[model samples]
Target chain A: MNAVIVENIIKTYGKKKEVTALNDISFDVSQGELFGIIGPDGAGKTSLFRILTTLLLADSGKAMVDGYDVVKDYKAIRKRVGYMPGRFSLYPDLSVEENLNFFATIFNTSIKENYDLIKHIYVQIEPFKDRKAGKLSGGMKQKLALSCALIHRPSVLFLDEPTTGVDAVSRKEFWEMLKTLKEQGITILVSTPYMDEAGLCDRVALIQNGKILSINTPRGIVDSFSKPLWAVKSSRMLPLLKELLQEDFVEDAYPFGEFHHVVMKDQSDEPLLRQFIEDHNNDSAVLQAARPDIEDCFIALMKN
Target chain B: MRTLKFILRKEFRQIFRDPGILRVILIMPAIQLLILPWAADYEIKNIKLAVVDHDHSEYSRQLINKVTSSGYFILTHYSSSYEQALEEIEKDDADLVLQIPDHFEKDLVRENEARLFMALNAINGTKANLGGAYLRTIIQDYNRQVRTEWIQFPRFSSETQIEITSSNWFNPLMNYKYFMVPGILVILLTMVGSNLAAINIVKEKEIGTIEQINVTPIKKFHFVLGKLLPFWILGLVVLTIGLTIARLAYGIIPAGSFLTIYVFAAVYLLAVLGLGLLISTYSVNQQQAMLLSFFLMMIFILLGGLYTSIDSMPEWAKWITRFNPVSYFIEVMRMVVLKGSSLADIKYHLLKMAGFAVVFNGWAIFSYHKRS
Candidate 1:
């Protein structure tokens, strides 16, 4: 059975129906697979996590986790699955060990029983075992939270934006820890707004405005981007962007850090685009063809 | 039960680890009990007086001596004119102006009647009324004394006299502290119990920690129980400290069984904690919880008959007190402590408290949703 099976979930907020937080959303995660729901902020990712974890009710639809219905068998589902919310939700006043032991004991288990599962992560922060969770650094807190969520050895783990605010190195280490957990045959469903992290997942569903734009393997989504994309940079990046968007052949131009990612209507129009920017800028601009990444695919899908 | 144990353990750990909360839980009630009773004393004393005597007769001098020696009033101004006495009152120097009129003794001796005019500053009506009543009683006693001494013949036959002898039962000294300490103890315990429990869940919500606990397999009843039990234990500790202070500091001991007091307190705490937990469940944040709890506590303390007797309350207020858990507990505390009321004597209150406990806690558990 699929670790998670959600069909046509719809959720809305407010008495006047001013916000449709989740709209006809559906997807499934395979057992022991690392699936990702990638989207920008307010993409209804947290809402979906809340619904699947049995912490919320979908306005209309059904969800099953670990072969149990979310509404009817919430108790059974609760025992089988672990959920780390988008924010660090552990007690700030309690020490790291206390938080872990509390979560473990509430699930009718002990830290010793789950020692083999969380030991790898727990050992890293064990030196500061008595330190309060609030005092821990962001990366340490993330690990401690993940350990608490996994204390019961849940069959499936749901991490909502686990790497949102961590430093780059810690973010990389966190993903490595997820890979380790996935290797141990725990189905993991993680959500993040970071587009680069999407490539790390086995399969991803791009969501926006409470709707899923596409669901595919990372490579599959990247391969489906048929537009000719290029990165263009100039001495005057701001003016170059304004000039690129005004051109007829330039399909889209958005500032992407050091370079502006420009998509052309035709691959043959790249030389013309470069010449046009050089003429407009008066001198000193560079343009080169760039392979489309997941971000490019996401922007293309959003545009379509 | 195991889940409850873990939850309670975590709650206690959090409570004790924070030294500020620990002090509030343990020490604040003791200080309040020790100090609040003295401030809330209702026995009116020290009526500042300005005596205006227009009559210069020997009887007037005697009456002035009588009023000055009464100990209840201080002769702030022994003025010869009513205007002078009124000036002292306007200056806020005198609470009452006792004007003994001319022929104060001649009319009393010839016609067996005399008149005294009292102009009181009644800004604080209770103080003014009590001071007025005290002066009236003293004057009547002085009048009787004068009649017996001045009249050689008997004013009336002894058989016609009705001597009413009365005793103040329960508190023979009419000590206001004795009356107030038990009531104040109830207020302290209620504040500690309700406010602490009111903030428990809401603090978790504010810190974002409640979401982690909600996804666990813990039952709703267990969650509410866990939230209540730690504060319940702390409240009982507060009650014990308050009672100890009441005994050592204020020299008060329950005339009835301490067991009876504990039995009542145990049940009363459930209702209080339940009400608090219910507030926490309804409030979206800690500030809201604090404000709502303060509002309820204000209503509960005022209507609980701590300062005002329920017998003196209007019929509708008395009806509301029937539903007030604080009223039942305060009444029970006073009955057992001062009146030495036995368990069977207070069975009605105990049963009502048991009913409150069941209803409030049941409603609290039912209203709390883990999936919301």
Candidate 2:
């Protein structure tokens, strides 16, 4: 049931032992599934999408999109897959409608033929169809680009960090649009740097340094972490994190937004954690055990 | 074929929508046609002349009068001695020096022939050659005038009369505008289309939309061709307007078929659009694309024979120009408009342009790798 199968893909740059963008990376996306490749900027997510889209040639690997090899059957694969890049790649000078139509025409299809599938999204920007794509708002451009990518009614969709620059509401709407596309039996493989949105994907792959650290359902990945996490906050929170790192019992300490998420090295017991805190001249300092999320699990995996 | 049409349509729409680019394509040619004639004349008008009259005689003064009276030479300095004239020539203040030897009036009547020296600056070889030839002819005519009685012919003997008419080819009067307008039209199209298309495509790369295109189902060729097509059509429209101005406004008529002109224009436009595509493919930003295209266009226009004849360029330069398709098309346009040449007459130039189209398009597609 895997819609996409990337096996041992390696892509390197420069002449003299330059950067290896994707180093023997391997993954699979199931049919009718929403797969997220979660990573920060320059973690080989874009490089993977390009290879799957057949826009790039891999150094040493085999990738199959919808049962077609990305290299040998690229011509066949191009017809069945839609790729939406991280940036707003639609023609800015062309009107919204013109941009959509031009892309549709490239695939030898028309907007009218696939209007129903894109109606929900395209209708939002229908009033500004005559306006140049460059003049459209960020959210409006995202919608138009998605509609154009889906116009050909591809079996699989590759969106390489599609919502990276979008607003919170737009990002929400964009994920909803992907859900709608998913309902149409399209396999959606989207990459993003947003950890919060990682929960929204049916399954997520946490990648870093050109390698996937772990791949599992977002909840399963979080639940599988064995560490005891504690949210520590004080009037002097940053100084507390620096002090906690020096402690023998504390395994890892990283700031997760407002408070620092801490884990102890000894799992058998809390290991005199309360005494270390009480010894400090602290008042109204809150320390409590908290539920770990996907990011916590990713941090644990990256440590190993 | 359908994708090509779509891409072409999109390109045209993009160019037409951007008013700045539209103006660049059309307005530049109109201005060049109207304004260029003033400054781009082959007939030298502003010639700087230095005269050294050793005799300081009336006859020597009359010879100076003849040189200035021709309306070509500009007399700026009157040198008292040959060394002073030599200094004037060496200092770059004078383009040509007129040296009359000592006792020029005594020598002319005494020796039956007196020599006059003209030192021409040959840096700009064309101007120097033409100016030198004109000066020599004018002084020779003055010499004949002085010895009119001595050089008399057999008087009024009834000679056998034969009437012959010589047909002048191309342009009988050799109107410079006729030669200029067609070539200028080609260069204008190239300047605007190549510059605009290149900038537009590279702008997308700079802004991050090129990644979007790469991820899309759109083929690379379609992506590039669609972008190139709009400028191609805009170039054609500008070229048509240029030809109309040539015929109606400037009174330089085309001696060949309009269809032939447009047909050739279609191929030539593709070649130029390919050049633009090639330029954009190498540039990651609009600034670099503009600079590269501008540099390439300068070479194209200069080698195109817009200001001077490519035929008259040096042997090495002429060899280099043979590879420039603009030179061929402009040459063909002139030959067709002036001489009324048929298809066979311009076979070489047409074939050359066709080759350029293939090579340029090939380069355009080949340069579409991951680098830029």
Candidate 3:
């Protein structure tokens, strides 16, 4: 059964509807599935999370969480779902233990009751249980927030951009925690702007401008890029990108890290492109046949 | 009930952890209560008098001596011309001028009547009015003295006299602190109660913790009560400190029972804290909440009849006092502290304050939405 379902959700902000925060958005998440909503900043990912968490009302639509209607059975849904806002919303003045204990008691449960669920994450920060949450480093704060969100043993969890400001190593550890939580049969819905994190999710919905562009497994999204792609790097990268975009057979080219990823319009051979680049550049250019990643598929789908 | 307890625990922990809040709650009241009453004294003194003694007579000299000795006036300038006295007034040296005409004591002996002219700067209406009244009283007494000296044999004289005696009730000494301390106590409690409660919720909103609380299954009533009761208790704590200061520092033992004041204060706090919560719900951040509460508090305190009597206010302003909860609490404070009024006497104020509590809390709860 589906753990969450959203249908035709439309939300607009401002008196004159000047900003469309969520525009007719729709998606669903199955039980125990690790779902990712990948988008850049201001793509209405937080708005969607707020709607599902019952902290906001959509302009018009229907959503259900754990078989309870979001509007009609909000109380029941609130009891079973956990939400971690995009910002660190825990009380900064509260110590780590006090913050966790407070959330646990308010949910009508004790910390020991759900000790097994958050033990791995809690043990790391246990030494600083008396330290105020505000003074903790960014990664420690994220861990505490996750622990607080999970203290009640929620059936479905919604984390909005949990890794946005966290460091690289902490971001990897946070995702691994999510993997363990999923192993315990908890369905998690996490949103991040990091394209690489998309591959770690069971399935992802690539959203932009409040509209979902594509929802598929990361491998499925990369496999759907039905064009030959090549990565070309030269000493002069900017000029090489401009020259590659000017090619008649080249469908698209964007500067991706050190190399320019060029999408061919047809099934063209790699050496032909290599020879063409060597003709333009006096001699120092390396070209290789490359496979598309989620970012590449995202750019391809966005362009279409 | 359990949720409320946990919320209260968290709130108290936060309140105690922040030294800024602790200082505002505990030390601010002690300092304000100790210092405000002395500065807010209503008895005016040191009225600078520029005397234009044109008469130069025995009676005039006697009158000048009497006025100068009264403790209210200071002889700033002794001038022979009214113009000099006027110059003194223009320079802001003298507050009032007494110009005795050229009588020479002849009109008092032959005509039995004399006139003296007095001119006051009148820039400060209260000081000018009181100074003029004091001078007139002194002159009246001197006139009676001269009449009695002329009529040496009072038993044979046919002149009739009326005597009046008055006594100040409740406060025999007419102590200004007794009148001011109770009112100031009420003001301090109002300020602390409303401002703390106002900032507490908005602080949560500012730091984004309120959104996390809203998504929980906790009822709105429980959440608001959790936010309110801690500040409500703090409000009462401030009142206790203020009352102790009033007794120990100012020697003002309330004429009424302490129970009456506590009963009234309990209801008054509900109304004030409700107002704070209402302001918080309407505001989006701590700064906005603080600014709005400060604006409302200024209006409430100024019109509250603590500094100014409501009876003397303009008709429109009097209407505002009727709606001001601060006015009701101040009146109740004075009634209990000065008049020794009991709970039975202040039932009307108690009922009105309860009504304010209902309206404010109801509106606050209605406007505060779990989902927006």
TM-score for all models, in order of appearance:
0.96, 0.88, 0.95
Q: Rate residue A232 of model 2 by lDDT.
A: 81
Clashing pairs in 2: B7-B226, B11-B230, B12-B230
Q: Kindly give the number of clashing pairs for every candidate.
A: 0, 3, 0
Residue range B324-370, candidate 2, lDDT tens digits: 77788887788778877777787776777788888988998987863
- Order the numbered candidates by DockQ, best leading: 1, 3, 2
Task: List candidate 2 segments past 4 Å from native.
Answer: A108-113, A268-271, B1-5, B79-93, B111-129, B149-174, B192-232, B280-285, B306-314, B362-372
Instruction: List pairs with backbone clashes in candidate 3.
Output: none
TM-score of chain B of 2: 0.86
For candidate 3, lDDT tens digit of each residue in B1-372? 888999899889889888998898788878888888889887879999999988788888888898889899999999689999999999999999988878748788888888888898888998899889988988888888887788576575576668788999988888888888888888888887788898889898999998999888889999999999998898888888888888899888889999999989999999999999999999999889989998998899899988889999999999999999999999998888989999999999999999999999999999999889
Q: Against the true structure, candidate 2 has what lDDT?
A: 0.83
> Least lDDT summed over 10 consecutive residues: which range in candidate 2 chain B?
B153-162
Please give the distance, in angstroms, between residue A283's alpha carbon in candidate 2 and its true position after superposition. Answer: 2.1
- Candidate 1 regions off by >4 Å? B109-112, B155-163
By DockQ, the best candidate is 1
Candidate 3 C-alpha error for residue B133, in Å: 2.3
Best by lDDT: 3
| lDDT at A219, model 2 | 90
